[model samples]
Target: MRVVQGTRPLVIFDCDGVLVDSEPLSVQVLVDALNRRGVEIDEEEAYARFLGRSLSTLAQILHDDFDHSIDAAFLEDLRHELYDRFRQELKPVPGIAGVLETLDSTICVASSSQPERIRLSLSLTGLLERFEPFIFSASMVENGKPAPDLFLHAARAMKTDPADCIVIEDSPAGIEAAQRAGMAVFAFTGGSHAGAPGYSERIAGLAPDVVFDAMPDLIHLVRQHMEGPDRHRSPRAS
Candidate 1:
């Protein structure tokens, strides 16, 4: 499903782990909130289960999978707390800004996080200007990751066919969604949460187009992918 036909390939970025190193911080908040209500989950469990998922998906999983339902009021408070923390402590994934500056492909962010959170995270890290009007949030579509809706919506809005796009993701849900949408995906493991138990194996098992552990390597990989037919062929084809 790796795309090789577009003149200007669209590269969709997943915000949290891929753009900003906020997963561990966000997961800590989520785990703390749930544990206060007796959910008894840990940070590693939270990341393994919900790393690239939206807040609604997390809420649904807590309810359907664990019988713990989260109300809107609670979620609102959690969002506020997350934003405040992000304002104080959030930082971009190391070396990502340089990659963004050097990448020649058309780019946009498609995140499970709210647009406001996305905006703030990028702004705090000084990455928002490059991606301002192009940020796509899960709230923009009927479904988030693990369903192809959000990514498909992004492809449509960007005027690119699914086959003409590639997603840079850091978790299984986003990789699965991109694949389902028929776009090639690259798993980025350079973020902080990647140190969690089973993180590398989890990504490896899903088999993204290629996995890279550094931002400079991503730039190199893209250069390779853009070299046309006999060059930059998808690994899946081989």
Candidate 2:
């Protein structure tokens, strides 16, 4: 048997669930923040409605769900307060450190999270510096997840074509966005609604190239792909 060594593939990652284990804490923060404003919501509902959406979009969802108007400014302030309260509790997903340290690919974060929240989460997880200028937020685009604009922006910024980019996401919206962008996706089943009813089927229905039940499994798969024979092929040319 021969071992293959080649250039790494370009990887685009979702910040919240894929890199940081912040979904549960984020849901808690949202619940607390909304409750403080006299609105209440459950975690499952939050997961279903806002898991992979931008803060602005989430505000709209809350507005529609509660039949109460939540202005952009109010949502911004609430998000800031939520971060202040919950940032310290945020942590990286298991095996993330090792995966990041061992990755041979040029990895960038393309997330639906606002840039500040993304920064805060990565900083808390001690993974902020790894991405640097490559951190892309959905707020940059007119449309967020379930729309291909964010991923397209990321692929463009990285100078890699969509087909060459591999997206790692944990939400149906994120998976759909990647698919629409014509990128290969790997669904991460390690977030708030991972084992929920129809979760597996939903992921499969999206036609992801792979689905991972654990961060370690995802890490291993990335390593193997990077070490595979086609790793050296330029994504743009492929």
Candidate 3:
């Protein structure tokens, strides 16, 4: 059922590393695809460069950095391979279901991935029903993350002011996007790939409203942020 908006804050979640443990699989597939094309990239490099970014951004990276061209056939093949892995191995982040159940906020997913990929990840992990009709994708906007267009679009679609929304994200780009959208962001680092060297520090450097590594702690953190004396202040407010 769609959440009926109330006085509760809207929580916007990122799909990949925030909701589903698909980053490792996605990075591995992307690296393999690039290797097959003789681009020679690694999973770590891919994670740093492309995590929380749209497919167009990834294609641009390939074009500019590796001098490789991305055509429809290449994208189709890559999508097919990634989807195959997701079906076989994707899992929800630990305790996320409980977090979702425990929260009373109006929640939705706003992600850098395509709409189909987001739905598949949620369905495979049995989380699709929780976010149907509320999923906003970068493909739906003119610009993706790190530009705030997707997050802002999501806020508008949900009929919530950006100041009244909170974004749960697992990437630097995502946190930056939420901040750019003028929404408070909580950095979630519990995903499997979050422990990469300097990754947490990088996320911290972005100065999200909260940084937490356990799903169970989310409700408390969000409540504190939403109910605390500072709740009315924008995350980027001076």
lDDT of each: 0.86, 0.78, 0.87
* Pairwise TM-score winner, candidates 1 and 3: 3
* TM-score per candidate: 0.92, 0.84, 0.94
Best by lDDT: 3
lDDT of 1 at 76: 85
Residue pairs with backbone overlap in model 1: none
lDDT of 2 by residue, 1-238 (tens): 0123564557899998889877777777777777777887767677777878887688777777787677667677767767876555676888888888787678999999879888988888889999998999988999988888899899899887675678899988898888788777789987755755666777788777688877777666866655555422222211
Across 28-99, the per-residue lDDT of candidate 3 in tens digits comes to: 998998899888888778888988999988888888988999889888999999999998999999999999
lDDT score, candidate 3 = 0.87
Which of the numbered candidates is closest to the native, going by highest TM-score?
3
Lowest-scoring 10 consecutive residues by lDDT in candidate 2? 229-238
Query: Which segments of model 3 are wrong by more than 4 Å?
Result: 1-6, 231-238
Model 2 lDDT, residue 61, Cα: 78
Predicted candidate 1 versus true structure: per-residue lDDT over 1-238, tens digit per residue = 3445445689999999999899988998888888888898998889888989988898889988899988888888888888888988999988898998998889999999888889999999999998979999999998888778888899899998777787999999998888788788899999988899999999999988789988778887876776645333222210
